[model samples]
Target: MLKLNYLFHNENLAEMIVKNWSYDPESTEMFRYYRISSNAIYPFRKDGRTQLLRFAPVQEKNKSNIEAELAFIKYLRENEYGVLVAVKSNRGEELAEIRTPWGVYYASAFVRVPGSAINQTDLADEIIFSHGHALGELHRLSSKYEPEPGAPRRWSYIDVLDWIDDQIKEYANAAIARSEVQLLREHFADLPVHTRNYGLIHYDFEYDNVFYDHEAKRCYAIDFDDAMYHWYAMDIEQALDSLQDCISEELYNHKKHCFLEGYRTAFDLPEDPDAVFPALRRFANLYSYARLLRSVAEKWDHEPEWMQHLRTKFEQSMRSKSTLFGTKLS
Candidate 1:
């Protein structure tokens, strides 16, 4: 825990909050504000009040992304049909000049929304419809909202293919790569079958970001960490397919149908949604395998030789005609 007295108005974590965090990790208990990243998040709870102090650094990678996320939250509150809320911290308070153990600290905050995050198994009828509707709403909002003059949001299907191809080249063990290549190639081939559209998007809406109250039968979205202007279709596909394991045929169909139905209710899906969905889903799966290959390789030291085994495992899975959803792909 880096001492951040000068940052938090000269207050430490214990001085700022009243909680039973004493039994928590010693490192967290040190700073009244613990930075989740060198310059991202610092979560502290006091008197049942939890606040995430966020900041952006000048020299940080995607430092400007902080601005984008904040802007997105502002947009969501105004237009989207969800219960999520954003907390506006003092401007430049996060980007303000402050000294710290990690260099400098920035500041931002969300409403400290509470609930269990969403999972695939939580896909009941109403929730499925809601997720679909949310996606559609997002697409509609993105289509109407304009980006900040200049944004990086024009990646193509070929570009996605290149990302997967490059990852496999960069880190794949030969045994794994060879087996996974067939499925990847098939997916890449299908990419040309669909066209892409650009729009403002909540590019990071994954299962964990969605809150599901199974009892109340309501759903909510949070965590605008990865929101950005992007291909709206790609963003939706990435969120739905990549984040949740759609392993059962019935469940996958139900989820996909509900997602589409809900989304269409809010905004217009493409005329060719059937084609668009599968192409995008294929790309996401290939991308996931690419990620798996690299993570296993880089973190090999942390997990022994399991790296090779996992790589091979995903490699073989890709070759199967059926997706995790149990649907056979063309």
Candidate 2:
């Protein structure tokens, strides 16, 4: 979530971003805050078409990261993969930077995908199948993608593990979390890597980042913010992680079977993808624990009521995951 101070002053900066894109003036009137975590997103109608403006503080994201993200999106589009395309500003820039007294903010715009997001309650089999196929197709394309010269590259999974260690090392549970991080780093180091089984991955390929177009019978993926270099099976594991909480084990097993079946249609699978999931789940847990800790650790004078409630929720989650990791590692 955005800090209280930034939220208060975001309106003027948002207007500046819209104008830089040369969007219709009415877009400013339609601007509505959509999300606040990791990035601040606003959805608005641009000439009667829905679009989104996303910006993040330099501390969270930098100009080079945004440029690399858009470049990958362009590559995916060129390869006929279904993904959101970035919108260029009037200055012919895919990413725009605004200097502020608080900090530098990088902004980018994208055409809002034209489909409803799927959730746990009403996830149909067809959507589940297409979800797997969509990720598989992306991995296939990623294997062949080479960034243009002088373009920034996405971070590797090990780089993120190092980051999580640095960010959370001072917290109460840092020792246990750091041990798990070391174990994960060593395990991945020993694993074999090849273009076919490892490449760029959508680190958060869950239902929220994907949309199903009913008429077209396809899935469009958004939010490449967490894209990174990792094993392809790690993507499948992350996509299936949420199902464990909401469904019976039998049903989860059935869904996994269906998902992998669809995945095989687009990309070849590792010989034992199932065996790799337990370690990957540990990685996922540690990463989420670090992010929640950071959110709860920030200081705000006169914090909002919602933030208090959110902080309580985050604390509960932190304790739960901390115990879970301690048990798994021990």
Candidate 3:
């Protein structure tokens, strides 16, 4: 579990940040702070435009990680990808360091992407297809990406699993969690990796992370904080999981088919993309379990009602070993 007490949760600190960045404190029209996992995101209005301020503890996100993330964003922008661009500070740095009573935090700003989140609307085939196409473009570009010599490398799948293993070891279902992780490791070990098949990817390419401009029929991606080195198929699986609660299976399948078709236009996937779902689903479950444990360990003493509800949901999912696509893990 990562510590989050150092977050810029108050207006005073938020105002200080605004001034520190040479932005007009009086021009701040709206400001809010929220947390997702260990990261603190501050979305605010200034200069008649919306912008996002994100910060994380140094231990959770070091300088190298920040540079890597910003570099990837810049690369994507240079390649004409629709992404939220990072804004340089007054000091001409993409990332800035802020010290508070709790700890040190690394902060960065991004220009707000135009349009609204796709999650606010019904799932349309065109939107789904566009999502797939955009991700495919990212994969194609990532296939050729080369980080600077000392840039932080994206975390491998095994790295995430090992982190989760550490989290679940103290839980009541430790053995079950460990076994599931081991099975996933075995399955992943058998998969082939090549430039065309593996590279950095937007691992969380779900609706909320993407914005849709209905008029322009374009999709813009934001929040590359979770981007990592993984198989291209994993991004597809995660996108499908985001649509798990569609009205019916028929509509879901139709949307998925459209998405895959769009993806194939840019890069070839496995003959049966569905074959990778089981392993990815198991990984998602383990990841969720690990997050639940970490959240509890960090915030259980001050847990809110929503957090408790989420804990209940995670516990049930873990006990059943349920996959996102309506299958039970053996």
Candidate 4:
């Protein structure tokens, strides 16, 4: 259920179901235009309070994996990790069942969260450095719990690298980036030796996945739906990559250094600071393949802009990795 959401939206139109969730006839309030993605996120009021509700469908195979995540978030929340206060529906169901155009989907909600998602400009020394500290705290606290085999944590670079190669080869029959895929494949074919293992990470850690208050110097990370096992070094790259994408060259380097300093203050590092680039470059390869498949799927859903932009971005990501190999990555 916590998997990438685009599929749910395409498989079943969730917006219509969300509209049905509202039993009120007033229809007086201006409903913000929200798309029905894999999840239905709606701005609603309960007892005069406004909040956001997010819901998704689950299958039998993934039920425990999803519930374990909710349980962990519950544990972390109790431990004062400062995560979302999950809003459960009637009868205290954190993961509830709801019938919809898509048959049935799981549902959960939360009070309207604060702060805008982070961007490059937000990587000023204060903002990003604080974010790094907060993330380090997250890794520190979350490391307290462990899963037997087969529990879902954030997805890692290694978990998806093989999957990426599979997908790129699948699209090898298309007009997509062949050379990029080749370079990616060449590196992936020999990745196991260079990869480092680390502690639990928010494998999906990215700037956009977190919220920040530049004024208060506070940051919050959301969407642990992809939380999984991986090296904390990967988490470092997750933070740095977002800054590099959002900010200018000069600020990017500065923010990255300070962010690393903050991270080290809270946790230990497994690899050299330079390791972040190669780690993320390898990560970017996997990201490209995922987006390419998603773009293809969305194109079938008539999202031309998303498809084309992802295609262009995929090539650009590959091009960006043209140098700095053998030394850092190999």
Clash pairs detected, candidate 2: none
lDDT of 2 by residue, 1-330 (tens): 343345443676777666767577766766554677768887766677888888887777646656777889999988878888788878888888877655787888899876767563267778888888998898999889888998898888988898899988988758888888888887788889999989888888888888888888888899998888889988988888854654578789888877787788999886688888888888888888888887777667887887777788878987877665644432
lDDT of 4 by residue, 1-330 (tens): 122334333413434433434323232142453434334565556556665566666552245555777777776677776566677665567766677656576766666546777763435677777778877777777556665477555444455555455545655433333444445456545533322334456665688777786666677677776565565666777677777778778677777878877776666655565644564566554465455454443234554565456557655655555333223345
Worst 10 residues of 3 by lDDT: 321-330
Best by lDDT: 2
Task: Tell me how candidate 3 scores on lDDT.
Answer: 0.74
lDDT of 4: 0.58
Report clash pairs, candidate 3.
none
Residues 1-330, candidate 1, lDDT per residue (tens digit)?
111122232334332221222223333443545533233455654344565545544443244565565555566667745646555433423223344544544444444565566674545667767766767776776666654677433343445455556656755343344344455556546443322255656655777667766666556677565454445676667666643473375567657777778777877676664566675565555555554444434332444354455446655765552244223455
TM-score of 3: 0.87
TM-score of each: 0.59, 0.92, 0.87, 0.71
Per-candidate alpha-carbon RMSD to the true structure? 8.3, 2.3, 3.3, 5.6
Q: Candidates sorted by TM-score, descending order?
A: 2, 3, 4, 1
Local distance difference test values of all predictions, in order:
0.53, 0.79, 0.74, 0.58
Two-way TM-score contest, 1 vs 4, winner: 4
Tens-place lDDT digits, model 3, residues 55-85 = 7778776476567888999999999899998
